[model samples]
Target: MLLALAVVPAVVQEAVLVGIGFHGARGLAPQVTAVWPYDSYHDLRWLLIYHNSWWHFLFGLVALAVFRGLLSAGLTALAWPGQVPRPSFAWLLRRNLEVAALALVVISPWAALSVAFSAVALSLYLFASLIPMLVLAPFLQRAGVARTWWRGLPTIELLGWSVLNFAVLTIAGAVISSTSGWWGVLVAALAGVANGLLWRQTVTAAVLPARIRLARVPVAPVAIILTMAAAVAAQPILNLVTGPPQEWMPLVVTERLPDRVPHAVIVIAGHDSHWSGRQPADPRVERFSYQGLDRQGRPLPYRHTATHRSLDSSSVLLRAQVEALHRRTGRPVALIGSSEGAMVARTYLEKGPKPSPVEAVLLFSPLIQPGRAYYPPPGYSGWGVATGWELRGLFWLVGLGRADRSRPDEPFVRSVLVNAPFYRNRTLCPVAGVRMIAFLPTVSAAEAPPGEYSRIPVFQLPAFHGGLIGRRAAEERVVDFLAGGHVDQPRREYALLQRLGAAWQAPPLALVLNPVWAAEREADPAFTGRICEPR
Candidate 1:
């Protein structure tokens, strides 16, 4: 009954906002049409009036606060039951108004911030919000159902529960909205029901007796750890029995020469599924597959297993195959890898006890990073903050040799690869002797060591990630380099390379994207910064 009453105001406010928005749209249409002759004016008016209207912001904030308060009260009542008495209609209204005012004052200031700045705001808000809860948890339990005043409220616990509920609901809504048709609605409805049951279970657990709670405390973590271990232990058996899917099989293109020693190019594909089973079809260059397959000959997708272990195993297998091929055909081998594959190749070279059979190594779109700060892209700044926590959780799972197959697109593997400090250490850069060439696209160019190393040549490509994979010009350059020829292009044209020559060194990961660099440059005319300067 209390939940129903709380929801009534929210429903009414939503309906009123829809009506107002529709009326505003109708009134603005004529003005939009009148300004259509001037494209710039029309765009400006549309952006200002339709997209960034103050009225919309006000209405949205009120609606969000009302819904949040309603959900908060409902969950609190559910959790504490007899202890948390049902709020009166007047009490509910007061609480909603308080929440709405807080949202407007505290959150609205940071709403206009950029993605990265907004992430900072979100972290601050989450931390600030949790403090009150941690402090009030004991007080709320002590208060029981004694008073109906604001001073006696369990605002922190209520807000925390509501936030979790909101997250589940939001995810369901997103899935529904992103889907094509009525199936989405059905799925969302089922999700909603499941979420409600889950919420009930969560509340029950929260209110469990002291003895029961203590007894179950260690069970969950232990179970999770054990399950992950079992999964990792079982992977080899699964791989052997299932066989690699056909797509996972190495794609080999052979080039045989009559008299001279044949030259072999071993290509290691990246994380992208599109590159699976891809091979260079050049007659002069033989392409050998380094990625492993299951027993059934089906491809084991990169995301299907614990990547670090799988890649390590695959790297070992690759060396054995290359050695056998070198023995039989007397071929000189060249290793070429892209993205995650590049990281794997680098790992093999670094960890191997002896020098590999490969005569040269060419890395494209390598995943080497100085630290965690450089992992996320510009667009990932905001949501990446939250996803970082998820990555931490999955990192342990992967460390235990368990694969998180549920979310293939999640940057868990990338997170692991980027944070591996050994790979980023300049002192441990692949041992000398072998010819090494790094062809890095703009985004990943920072991964390469600054300046020229003895046998390592870092070439910057004026393109984004994955741009050099199949391009004819890029492929030709790679082939030429592998054949003991240097890249003919002017190296000075690349901004990153030029900066390296000008004493612009790669900064630590935390400072790489620091806004202070921009601020310092803006403040001083001749301030040449280490980070974010030209490069």
Candidate 2:
């Protein structure tokens, strides 16, 4: 309840502000501006300020319970004359000193959210909460009523839950223009409680028996240690089996825009974590920024102004390229985007004068939104989008592992790729009727907002092993764009499908510029020198 009292007000405040921003703003533009300025800070601060309140409250309640036990023993000693010498207060004090220290290590940072911590604090808060739930589950299960109650636990008793709800609604409101505030809050609350209970069970079952007194020559301490280690191991294993979901990460540049006009294509490189790599990858630049380098130069600590991948610096670099293209070629240039490069293209277009300055856009398995997926379906008929797993693999190949479980303090490497200085000075994209020729493994019209996108012609490519098998998609899309051929899907699909089915599916289609060769080294080092030539 104390946790609720402390956390709810802040949450309510943020959510209310977000709702006002949503409803009160003149339209999308002002709301977008307001949402970023206040909602983000408010959401983050809310997390930091209130993460530990419930844990603190729990500590007090437990300490009180221990005190009650000790006090009862003392009173019994006076009445019964002999009984167990009322266990020494000095001994109790000394033992509890260790307990208090441990508790502080566990709870204080949570309560204070000290040190401007991020994922770690949240993890600890979760860990401390989970321990007791597991220990008590059997009892609750036996109680039947308690088990049912726990499953659909009510909001009022849970600590910091309401606060979590409010924070989620505000943030969601900030990002998605049409989210329902009350529904968002309700979903957040339910999710938080359910997750909290799950965490509590996992942690308490692992720890308390070890740290506290245990009967029968217990090895609970060692067991607890092993449990924690196993939990850590479980994470990577889970990622592998479940095929870690795609997440947004920093964008990187593969090549610079041509100084001359009518450039053939804009190549943007994808990134990867290189967990298996030994040496660090060298840095390169694709944008103009605070650090002031147009080509590969050192970076500053400053963050990008727009989305993490859409860097101001890189956008500036692209803006310069765009201006030069119009001047030199006497005709607007065409853009070729791949992977995270698509975001660079999108941001460039968002700055306006695109499709005009650049007549058309050609994307190859583009990372339109960082880490989110565009999936392909179960059968050939289902071939309209790329599945979540393929995109995750694509990122892993680029050395920019999964975004969902990202380390909070990670520097914005991908973000730097698109951070062009010029983009900051420009307005967001409002250009109309510029052609967007999208070459995707699957182009799902369903995933797109009904009318959010304009005049974008998507070309669906063939799939193999439930994924985009080769360059057929890219080739056809480019060929059509350059040739000015209207897409004839029924005829094209029949021919492609027939050829793929014949000759035992024939040889794999070749690519003009295969991203796979670059991704190969990071994916598996044994072939690094063989395929990538050890660069």
Candidate 3:
């Protein structure tokens, strides 16, 4: 019943939001209806990455406060004794708004910071899962949520939900996850429902009568996985009717790279990793340099810096190398880049002059933002009706020489964050003709999933930043994708991510099955034109 209650409102919420054309902001919806563990943190994350417009985002927040807030409070009131006086609407609204504001201002950033650091990623996920049960449940219970499966059992804390979650995570989470295309959303939601079932003793005693009771404890796992499988299998056929996800890309990873795969490719190393090291044995693959260094790995007068000029410099070298390789092999060059080098590859595709050279790009955890480890998008979204002023503001920022010009990665922090079209264009529209896939570190995204907000088909790896650079599996998957062969995800590592409280599911189901995919695209733009355009 608790789980069903959560799902029921989610359908209504998603429908109303989409019916009004705000699917981009749907990330703000509970991962699985109302059983969401972290409310404030997720709400803010969706607003920045998946929002349609500031108005839409704000409207969603208000709706969350009014509808969810009022409903939750009403339920709490009803759960208490009949003699108790119900809280007034004004009081409920004020309390909900306060909690929402507090989350947006204080708690959200702190949670984001905890996830950004790799060492703390798993701990953060645990804390996130616990927030709903340990913190919110108790608070509401104390505030008169009289009935819960909360009886104090004998050492059940040591033997119950923790063990159950751990077992489910180890045996099923990731493997079952792939079965359903909607793994990210549905499993996340169901797991959310399961999170509250930790009170085995109390739940068994009370819930056996009221509803699904503890059956959901075992049943949810089966439902989530089977549902995901059906969705994934059905998606390709459905796409025939709806058309391909033009802007969205779907990809997977592996464990090893075949040594003798016959493909023409170029390898771009991350910051400071140049041709000085032992080169790859395969003659089909060549490594390029952007630090103005000689082919023998000697440094030149110019050094790489965090400016647009460095991007132009490396992009020019990339063009020359791709053209050379293409001519030699009589085939298009496939780009494989790691870290900062991946950003260089991204810049070339986005801003490098027409007629893209590379046919396929495999980027290992590219830096999407310039300055900060994580930077949320500014509000407003688009230029409303007048798109021309978008270009004018960009020109004014560029012509006025306003970039900080740091000396680390490719672009200055201000360039991307301050609307200079740093990595992605400030206007944030999709460009044509380049097949690109990004492999992201699961640890980095364990808590705050930056890739979820990206338009690129981001493949989650069990490895950390720079972890997938030479992995044979990733290399093999890249080869398979380039050759149009079968591509699938790694088997075991995904469970590690799931154990840490994230749904390490693949992306295709949402792209195909979810009707609000276009809104998701809008929500996940690089940057928007809200600054000078009055969106």
Task: Please name the candidate that would achieve the greatest lDDT relative to the true structure.
Answer: 3
Each prediction's RMSD to truth: 19.8, 19.7, 14.6
State residue 269's C-alpha deviation in candidate 3, in Å.
3.2
Best by TM-score: 3
lDDT of 1: 0.39
Candidate 2 residues lying further than 4 Å off, grouped into runs, are 1-263, 271-310, 319-331, 350-356, 362-430, 437-471, 478-535
Question: What is candidate 2's TM-score against the reference?
Answer: 0.34
For candidate 2, the per-residue lDDT at 235 reads 40
lDDT of the candidates, in the order given: 0.39, 0.31, 0.41
Models ranked on lDDT: 3, 1, 2
Each model's backbone clash number: 16, 48, 11
Give the lDDT of residue 103 in candidate 3: 36
lDDT of 1 by residue, 1-535 (tens): 4333323432343234234332111111111111001111112222211222345534555555564445544543543445534656556445544543443333221121111111211122222222222332222222222232223223344335444443443344334323332443343344434444443433433444232323324432343344334323333444477565333222223333223324666666655333244434544343334435445432333433333344566566566655655565566777777665676677667556466677777777665332322224323432133233333444344345544342313443443323333433321144566777777665433223233221246666577564566556676677577657776452544544322211111112222233322322211101111111221
- Model 2 vs truth, CA RMSD: 19.7
Q: Tens digits of per-residue lDDT for model 2 on 1-535?
A: 3223223333443355345432211111111111111112222222222222345434544553354234222222222213224336554444333332332322222222211111111122223323332322222211111212222222222223323333433343333223334443443333333333332332232222222222333333344344334333434654587573332211223223223323333333222211111111212112222222234232222222222333334456566665554554455556555443454566667654533466666554443212110112223211111211222332343334534343222233323212221111121122465556555443322111111222345566543211332355545445456445555232244223322111110011011112222232221111110111122
Quote the lDDT for 205 in model 1. 34
